[model samples]
Target: MASVSALAQVDATPRVSAAVTMEQARMVDIRSLVPDISQSIAYAGSNNFVGAPIRGYQAPRCWLKHEAAEALARVDAALRERHMRLRVFDCYRPVRAVAHFVRWANDRADQRSKATHYPDLDKSKLLGDYIAPVSGHSRGATVDLTVLRCDAHDVDCEPLDMGTGFDFFGIRAHTDSPEVNAAQRANRHLLRDAMEAQGFRNYAMEWWHYTLRLEPTPDTLYDIPVTAPTDSGRQAEIERLMQPYDGDVPGVSLLVLKDGKVVLSRSYGRSDLERGIEASPATGYRLASVTKQFTAAAILLLAQDGKLAIDDPVKRWLPSLPKVADGITLRNLLDHTSGMLDYEDLMAAPYEGQIRDAGVLALLEKEDRLYFPPGSSFRYSNSGYALLALVAERASGKSFPEYLRTRIFQPLGMRDTLAYVAGGPEVPHRAWGYSKACDGWTRTDQNAYSAVLGDGGIYSNIADMARWAAALDDDRLLGKASRALAFERQAQVSSTPEATWYGFGWRLADGLQWHSGESVGFRNTIVRWPKQRLTVVVLSNRNDPTPYDLAISIGRWFMADAQAEPH
Candidate 1:
């Protein structure tokens, strides 16, 4: 989460979208609307607020029509009179996220998290109960909110104890549920009264939902277009184009892919700082956590060569590593169950000298308490992956970058993708990564950790990602078994449903296997829905969560297009 100070009253986005002709009705670009309605966060942070950091929490990443937002805010004001205000859960959800929700709602395989949230509700009927056949927020006219009350000064909001939490899907979340306590009932009423008073309507089952009496942009929800911008290009353009829309972001970038045709893609504002460059399918940008997939692929390739085993204990490689719970295996390290301390946090604690993988391990040794036993649960750990990079180095007699060059990157003909740095040959058509600092659209300080290959360090474009996806699916990289394992449910997370399935390095969301990468200067996610033969790849150099939601919306549009076809 970002270190937030007091902010002023409701901020509205001010932007003048470059004209979109009627034939090309501009779709909602979530990143463009992030400033107005998002909670502030540090770049590449774990801003879960509720769970283990929400995987996709970028803002200005989305937009709600002006009238719809104002109506919702007025309702929020009404609740304020009752010493309550609507604490928004989500607004202007991206089309991509809606697609993800649909896919998850249809996932009949697991009824586990549902059981935990709604013990009284039948698991088989959740789609009808919680999932909407179509989402209203996609129209940008609805919002999700909960009632919170505190001192008149707007401090310490005590959210009423509703039977179910914000994202919970069950009868308990119903506004007039007889199963709830008086306090819960009162809370639900306050929420409903506030919204209903302001020309809004509530969804009976969810107390947190309300739709604007009128949608401002009816019949015009946009499908974010694809582009390739260096992180610098997006940051610069967002300030100007989004300024009319008043976009405020920590950072952002555009993706460019060549070869594996992009039927459609995403971009923000203009890529050229001087409004010179137009992002294309082949623009190369920094690949933050996306680097992990490459790192994981490299390891699998090593394993295929009989150099390392997935089951090998990490201690076997990094012998000097501080001791952790004995059960933690190499797989745990790769899968993020190692229970080692997050090396980033450890590096921050009154440390000495330049921090490296060894320093990180020392901190983990100091804090060996496990969130859960290895293989029993999953928690994302950059430290775990970083160690794998080192392990690859030790096991194979080459640097991590060199190993990838000789083994994975080179073999697959991913000529453009590399662990790029400042001194390298000027990256062709490279989009610069930028931030809206006190200055403006200035290049972001290159991520200190960008040099590390495991967590985030590789750099490529849309073209490279498409190549990666194709290889993972049908290429002769590591055989079909290795690719299958990459997309399967490897870890069973208790509270985190979307990421329950994590293979080697990919996070499985619905039927789509994907992972989101965020860093000081870039945020990106690529989902390959093999079942549907769809690939939604969104790469932004901005360190915000907007791209994840944006990618999901793009997926929905494609699915809709497919279903409406004459075939």
Candidate 2:
């Protein structure tokens, strides 16, 4: 449900013939405010999600800026002499949404759809073809598009079909696909020509993608939290009924909910621990492996679509899957019982394709051994979760980011949450992760750099995390049975066999649903006790903030308070 592309203009008459200054629209894009003039035009374009160019569309849904609309009006007027008008495919987008596209194209679950969209394409051949982690759209001025008829009275103007559907990844997404008729290709060229005339650059692989030379906003990208529309009651009572994280001291944010109401929240310590910027509920942290729950949610959504079954063997799609490290089920994969080795161990530092999840299988597929029989015992292997990440990719016909965004992140309105990659522009109100030593604090890697896409790579704030906990408690994110199964503790064999417990990336301590993640320079924890409406989360950038001890004490505090509260 995010926009397919970015940088759109409205061919419209400007009221007072005035243009809105970029100074006026400092944060939100100007394209979001006013209408365009050439309303009858439409376009054909391809999306990375489906990996092919799709034809037949309508006018833009989001509006254009007053100046851009006026500029478009001028262009339309000039083109009017030749019976031409601008057509569009997509517009201003959230950069995180582009990450969504990468996730979808990598998914193998819906081969049927791929076959229909790009008949000559291979689902396994996506990375080199359509998907790449970095995106031009993220720059805020690019778009994917094609032209349409402007002559409303000219004998029922026909819509041209592109060679393949939007989101197709093969040669079909190319502008020169033989499958499309010459006229259809000509129309595409016409739109491209118009945009190029306006100084917008087109992407070579995807002819629809274009970036404006003079962008409305150059460097500011807002990390707006996805929020539910607040009713008057909730809005009015929020300040009064809500709790505030008053501890702004140790760079930690805490929120406690009881009987469906927020009871307490405290934040302490500096967010910019060096600059002495105090932490607040808005201080964002890399969710780290807290992302897997959303990845698991994507797989379940695929199950809901009947695209794949949770209990299916991983080898069903990845036929070259190594022999059962144990008698592993997708269930076990979800629960991390598959004895797959942890991929994080293989990389010294993850960045620039160093530790991609897909590469893990290729690495393991060649080995003649299993860490253990798949079901023989359990190990807290990121490798197991990494492979299940592949299952999610294959099953959703989307990248891990897209699957989570569309099915999980967007649905819960965790607006500020993002399965974000690094190297993109820095976001606002975002807390940079830190690694503190005698050398002082240095920015730790972003979640995406860990190459732990499904197992980690999500960045969010305490507020968004709170919403995630609430969503899980409501069971709106997953079915009751799935939720019950996901939270059920797993009995594992380790050095000490009797006390080991884990559950689908969720660990259990005293019947609490919990999980902890660690990597270079950071540690994170989240614990939820649904029966008591209890949730705890601690995200620290330093290699060790003693999170386990802090979580234990916090959990004890909540439990003690529960015992004392009168029913």
Candidate 3:
């Protein structure tokens, strides 16, 4: 059951107060202390019962009173010792956001989120039990979270089944509901025990909701906008860093993520210069080699399903390959140690049609020898990924693109991402690629190899890419063992300028995992510091200077002590 104050806040006659000043309150970003604590701020996005971003939630960052934040961090640390984690859905709600919830609850016509959030109860009936006029979250000591079970290495993690999803407006959502199964009840008890040990009390009516036993400011509500840490000055400095893309020409979309939430998302210049459309977060750009990560993930997923294995020889999947590829394994292809010849070099002069994945396989099938014995040395090979895509199709009994859609993209909520193929599916919110000509930028979106599905044909936007990154960080798609295997160092890429290794599709160097993608008219880079739980993505449509170095610079700004690493 909800506390007396919690019920009182759910008054029949709702009221909205003027925004309060936040200058006197000492607020802290929870991630500043608990960097690994996962977040999926429901009110900050359209996934909540409101069906839109609640007012005053500028970003998905979590904030809490200083004492509360420290206590929550302790809880997280204790969970980590047990190979588990705390994933917060809401923390320190704004008074305005609570008002937004109140207004939405009062409106009888809006039932858009009813089927999913409040299936059994009428929308009007939710006001007393769920849609409260005032929320303890505004006091900055309250939180909504669930437990995530993890592997021994704390890599792959998934939320425990607590009978109902976050914000579910039904009795099943009750922490001790008899309607829930035994496992669900035990999971709820597990969460309650951990939280209570840290001086927090759970609201019985909502399994996810919690408040500090000794709240620092129980009566005072905050209206301060929830934003990334030190957002003002840092945002300005980042804007200056991105000045090159701030004009009416082919530009870039930059997304910075920290603690599983967006820290920054901004786009500059025009996605379609001829159409006079400015680039926005939603503008999809060809990911080029960055698509390799997704390709690698698809194979790993198939392996999880018992369709294939990383150590399995390439010949096992694509028997059409000549004897030269007999020594190559899927792991070799992933780590760039296949010694496979580059497909581009094999294409005869003035190749006529766009080459697809199957065509790449055909070209390689005719080759007599690899550059070196498989697994002997590192050599970047686009042909390897192309064959891997075909292998995925053959093993899964589905088209490569179809496997990516149903198995990877759609499952991860990467709705805007796709393995682009001609006449397959039109990319929504497309950003045509560009080349810097003498007079102006010219559209050079596609070339002979544009249709290649595996190596670099997927198109995605920053928003979707963020979702993909989140999946990689959590056990949304791949399990802990699979994720660890994918990121583990397999082959040494370089030993000169700095120690760098290749893992599946990612480059590992000095505690950082990164990769760059370049094609005819797109240059992109995604740099991630897994330990720090930060990721920087830069996507450009114009072919000129590569964005890898720029992406590193942006990442360095966020990292307190960045180590020297390869681009």
Candidate 4:
């Protein structure tokens, strides 16, 4: 219930100094004190909610006050006795980083990190409970950490599931939230018990956050950068890795978020080839199947409001549907298990023009049978989502686009996103799709079947997509239970590389929840490693190959060291 005005009332004050000698004399690197302790300094990399290295984190290292370091080392030693080790995510945050958080919170337009951290609450509410101009971490006595299991040799450590990822800005991450499973709650209790034994007090809102009961310098905030002297090479390496996406031809807009923050946002190519408009972060491209998730979300929202139940028969909302859909429920439609026939397949060859969402439902009414019995098997069907959109309209008494505009897009602050309709308002900063031609790039923006609203038809840019990604973190739009249901694996779909399952609108594979979009001249993919808080969104204007491979490669790079305990 936090409002933007409340955030504005908080004072904006700078609170740090650049004296290196004072910091060096008072602080010791936690790793130096406890070399055996595991460390994954999230703020030092792009894998945090901020998405980039925080202002003061120059390196992926943990530093703390001498006393805190000694006490943490004891915690590590004690954990080792039980075949576990203390894995620190953060320690001794710089005051500059705390200030960065404050600035981010104040910028209402910058909701890029909203989905990953503060999904259920407005940015304004975070000022007092979550973020502030000053932080206990700056005192060099506070730490954010988790427990990890180690092999007999104390190597190959893996993090235990504590219900939510570190820095998860939601109630699910609370130490006492009952939303988590029993085992997850137990893991959290174990961490709390261990940390408290060493004079560390856990912050109630954040399971991984802890502060010393008796800090050495509670009043002093340090301004020292967290980077090591040798980190220049690493910075150069990151730049080199992203150099390929810089150009002026029909280009790609890539936005990578790790832990809900934009770690990489690059635009390469042209937004308009005829006008020679260079593509940038504002470039909007049509998202084909990527739009399905939003459609699913709308249905979920209606269900959340008691307007409808997911288990209700499709006929409850759309009485015009054929009798074959009698056994099909809305949940079946959301998860692609409705066994609905593909509308595209039903369309006659040499299609006349673009088809809209209502037209899709009309076409379905003419069909006498389904591809399979409802919930009997798994088959990806665009028809299922299209119908769900219609159901949302019938239940809410609003058009699909209007429902999303007010419910999902506007609420999440996705200012530049929309469900594209044939005669709808023009999309701002639109990136026309293109295909490679013998002469050059050929504009092939929309297909004969492109106007469909539910299955695809959503147009969005990187900035808006980042907000959409952040909304998945908590229950501001959907309750925690509803959000969980969206990602819950409903049926087995494939078994390549690893088992793949179909959730509400997501394809789950090997700890990744992802979906790819493909249109006539546009190809895009959004991959989310939820547990790692890493997301890769690749949006392209050209009809190139699917961006799935590139997205996966990037996801792996960001999650290179992220390992969870075996299920």
Best by TM-score: 3
Task: Please provide TM-scores, in order, for all candidate models, with all chains considered together.
Answer: 0.53, 0.52, 0.59, 0.57
- What is the clash tally of candidate 1? 54
- By summed lDDT, the worst window of 10 consecutive residues in model 4 runs over 1-10
Candidate 4 lDDT over residue span 241-278, tens digit each: 43333322466778888676888776655667665455
Residue runs of model 4 more than 4 Å from their true location after superposition: 1-245, 561-567
How far does residue 456 in candidate 1 sit from its true spot (Å)?
0.8
| Model 1 misplacement above 4 A | 1-261, 265-278, 349-359, 362-371, 421-428, 437-442, 494-499
- lDDT rank, highest first? 3, 4, 1, 2
> Candidate 3, clashing residue pairs?
none
Per-residue CA lDDT of candidate 1, range 1-567, in tens?
Answer: 211111111134222233332123333333333322222221112222221222233432333566665666566556666655544455554344445445655676655455445466665565554654345655556666666554554432445677776555555767798878998898788777777777777777777777776656544343332221123433444333332212223223333222344564333332334322334445567777878888787777777789988888888887766555567787887777776667776566454444554455666767757667777767888988888888888889987777877787777777777766456545555665666554345556364455556777777777666667667657568776667656667776544434456778888756767778877656678776667777777766444454766666556656666678797
Model 2, range 1-567, lDDT digits (tens) per residue? 112432223343211212233223332322223222211111212322343322212212222333344444444455545554333444443334445555665677856455555566676666544555444443335544443343432211123355544445555556666656887677667656776676665555565565666766454332222221123442223321211111111245555555545565544444554433445566666666777776676666678778888778778867776665435677767777676766655544643555667877776776556667766677666666677778887877787777776777788887767766556424335555666645345656544337667777777776777777777766678877667666777555343543546666676655567777676555678877777777777766556564655665566666776788798
Task: List candidate 3 stretches off by more than 4 Å.
Answer: 1-232, 561-567
RMSD of 3: 15.5
Note the Cα lDDT for every prediction shown: 0.58, 0.55, 0.82, 0.78
Largest lDDT belongs to which candidate? 3
- Measured over all alpha carbons after superposition, the RMSD of each candidate to the real structure, in angstroms, is 20.8, 20.6, 15.5, 20.3
